[model samples]
Target: MLVTLEGLDGSGKTTVWERLRSDDMVPDETVFTREPTDTWYGDAVQRSIDDDDADSLAELFLYTADHAAHLSNTVRPALEENRLVVSDRYSDSRYAYQGATLADSEMLDDPLSYVREVHAPWTRPPDRTVYLDLDPETAAKRSGATNKFETADYLATVRDNYERLIEADPERFVRVDATADPDTVYERVRDAIV
Candidate 1:
């Protein structure tokens, strides 16, 4: 099972993911990992985020490269050995965040289409996706000014993109109200898992 957790920053993805990890909630063969891996690909994305002049399209490409390395070097090997892979974030984050960032750009005819195209070969359909849904205001309060995309307006747009993704394929996503307490949210997350 390739279970990817998706949501805005400070949406309790880390908290819930930790619970899912330490609690031994998944099968015994579970392996936990995340994108923007610890490789140079990961470093490049991190650096890009801190770069004041980072282009939206360039940032998107950086993420795509990270995903490619993550799959080839980490995820696929674990899955090949029959381990259930639970990721902190996945391609959905790109579609939600970068796609929203590029939506207004005249550079691309269609940002989402271009993003989907860039990630087409490496995109792995999640067996299930848990989206910890929290409004931008609350999320901002939890994590203040983390990056360029941390603004309420931008996060709201990202949230909308996530909603659209879920709507497009309802079975692929399970929405969890992240405003609830961690324990309560963890319960919902476990229930949502296939």
Candidate 2:
């Protein structure tokens, strides 16, 4: 099972992942990994994140490269061995973040479709995705970074993109109200996945 937790930074994904990891129900073979993986491509993506002038398309491609490397090096191997895989972020982040940022650019008519099309060839979608929904103001406050995509307005657009992705395939997502305490949020995520 490839389970992924998706939300804005400081939306408690790490906290929830820790709780899930410590829970007794999780299998021993479960392998935990995250995007912007520990690779050259991932390094590029991280660097690009802090670059104010970075092109949206460049960021998208960087993320895509990191994703491909992460899948081949981590996710696929774990799955091949019959172990469950839990990831921090995945295709949805690409669609949400990049789609929102690219929306105003002359890159493509539909940034969402462009992202989706680019990722169509990647194998294995998450068995389940938990989207911790929170207002942009709260999420922004929770996250202290002042990176290019950390603004409230940008996050709001990203949330809208996330909503569209969820609407496009409702069954694949478990929406959780993330304004509650960390333990409470984990409870929702636990319930959703269990």
Candidate 3:
């Protein structure tokens, strides 16, 4: 089973994923990973994230390359061996974040759809996705507004994209409120997964 944890930065995705990875409740052989992965492709993505003037389209491709490499190098093999796979962030993040980035560019009339279509043919869809729900302002504050992607205004657009994703595939997404205390949020995420 491929279970993905997704949300805006500081929505507690990495924190929850870390705890879940160590929790006794999960399977011992479960495979935990994230994207952009810890590869050179990921390094490039990180650089792009730091570049305030990076082209939206270029950034999207960087994310796509990382996802492809991640699948080939990790996700596919783990699933083939019947291990439970959990990712902190996956393709959805690209679709949401990059979609928002390109929204005002006028290069693509439907940025979200375009991003999804780019990955539709090759990406492996998660069996389930846990969306940590939080307001954009709170998410920005929690994330420290560190980069272009962490701002409240931008996160709001990303949130809208996420909502569209959920609406399109309601069955695959499990929504969890992130406003609760850390322990409560962790418990909720654990329950949703287990």
Candidate 4:
């Protein structure tokens, strides 16, 4: 089974993934991974992220490349072995964050749709997704507004894209409020997973 944890940068999905790694509740052989993976492709994506003036289309493709590498190198092999796969972020991150980034450009009529279409052909769909929900202001604060994507205004647009994704595939996603205390949020996420 493939499960993905998704939300804004500071929504605690990464924290939850870390906790899950040490928890006895989750399967011992479960594979936990993330995107922009710790690879050369991801390195390029990180570089683009730090460059505020980076071309939106270029950044999107960089992220897409990292995700593709993540699948081929890690996610696919684990799933082929029938191991439980839990990823901190997946293609949905591209659909949300990159879609928001490209919103102002005249490149595509619907950025979110365009992002999804780009991934639709080869991406492996998660069996379930735990979406940690938080307001944009709070998310920005928690994330420290460290990067262009962490800004409240940009996060708000990203949040909207997430909502659209959840609406389109309600059955695959479970929403967990991220405004609660860390323990509470983590518990809810773990519960949603197992």
Candidate 5:
């Protein structure tokens, strides 16, 4: 099974992933990856973040490249071996953040459709997508001002997009309230998968 955690910055995805790994709730054979993964492409994404670059399109392409490399080198092989794969973030984030950035740009008419047509075909969707829901204010407080993309306003829009994504595909997506305790959220995730 391939499980992915999706949420706004500071929604506790990294914490949850670490907890799951430490607890061995994530299978030993399971491979864990995150977007802006530790690759050259990922490094570029990180640089973009650090520089506070407004080139949303460049960031989007970097993320796409990272996803493609991650899938080809890691996720797909693990799946082929029948090992569960858990990812902290995936393609959905691109559709949310990049799409939001491109909302008013005449170039991005239908961001989802564009992503689906251009990038979706190259990647695999997760078996289950877990969205850790939290309010923008709370998310910002938790996240701090580390990344350029972690703004409260942007996260609010990302959260809304996540909700819409979930609503469109209820069967594959699970929304969990991250405002609760970590254990509570972990239990919910465990229950959902098992």
Candidate 6:
């Protein structure tokens, strides 16, 4: 099973992911990963987070490259061997952030179509996506202002986009209230997985 968690920063995804991983609830060999993965492309993506040198389009391409590398190197291989794979984030984020960035540009008409034409050949969609839903105010309180992208306003927009994405593809997404305690969140996620 390929399970991907989606949410704005500080939505408790990492905390819940850690709990699930440490509890050994998935399997001994379950491959866990995060986008902006530890690769050269990922490095470029990370740098774009704060550095103003690159524009949003550049950031989008960097993230796409990282996803390509991640798919070829980690996700594909693990799935081929029948190991469960869990990711902290995935392509949905690119669509949300980049779509928002491109909102003022011509690409806003069909951001997903653009991404599909450009990156879909190498990427694989997650079998299930769990979006940890939270208010931007609460999420900001949990995650400090470290990046320009983590603002409450942007997060709120991200949340809205996430919901729209979920609505657009109901079968793949499971929205969970993230304001609950970690244990409660983990239990809900576990039940969803089972």
Alpha carbon RMSD to native, model 1 = 1.3
Q: lDDT score, residue 152, model 1?
A: 87
The per-residue C-alpha lDDT of model 3 at residue 192 equals 83
TM-score of each: 0.95, 0.95, 0.98, 0.98, 0.94, 0.92
Task: Write down the worst ten-residue block by lDDT for model 5.
Answer: 112-121
Which candidate do you rate higher for lDDT, 3 or 6?
Answer: 3
Off by over 4 Å in 4: none
Candidate 4: residue 25 Cα off by (Å): 0.5
Model 1: worst 10 consecutive residues (lDDT sum): 20-29
Worst 10 residues of 2 by lDDT: 142-151
Model 5 has how many clashing residue pairs? 0
Candidate 6: misplaced stretches above 4 Å? none
> Root-mean-square deviation of each candidate, in angstroms?
1.3, 1.2, 0.7, 0.7, 1.4, 1.7
lDDT of 3 by residue, 9-115 (tens): 89999999989988999999999999989999999999999999998889999999999999999999999999999999999998899999999876799999999
Model 2 per-residue lDDT tens digits across residues 1-194? 78899988778888888878889877777888888787788889999998899988888999998898888999988989988888988889999999998999875999988999998987578989999998888888888756777778899999999999899989999999999988789888988876
Better of 2 and 5 by lDDT: 2
- For residues 59-100, write the lDDT of model 1, one tens digit per residue: 998999899889888888988898888899999999899988
Q: How does model 3 fare in lDDT?
A: 0.94
Name the runs in model 5 displaced over 4 angstroms. none
Each candidate's clash count: 0, 0, 0, 0, 0, 0
Task: Rank all candidate structures by their lDDT, best first, as comma-separated numbers.
Answer: 3, 4, 2, 1, 5, 6
User: Model 5 Cα displacement at 88 (Å)?
Assistant: 0.4
Residue 94 in model 6: lDDT: 86
Whole-model alpha-carbon lDDT for candidate 6: 0.81
**Between candidates 2 and 6, the lDDT winner:** 2
Clashes of 6: 0
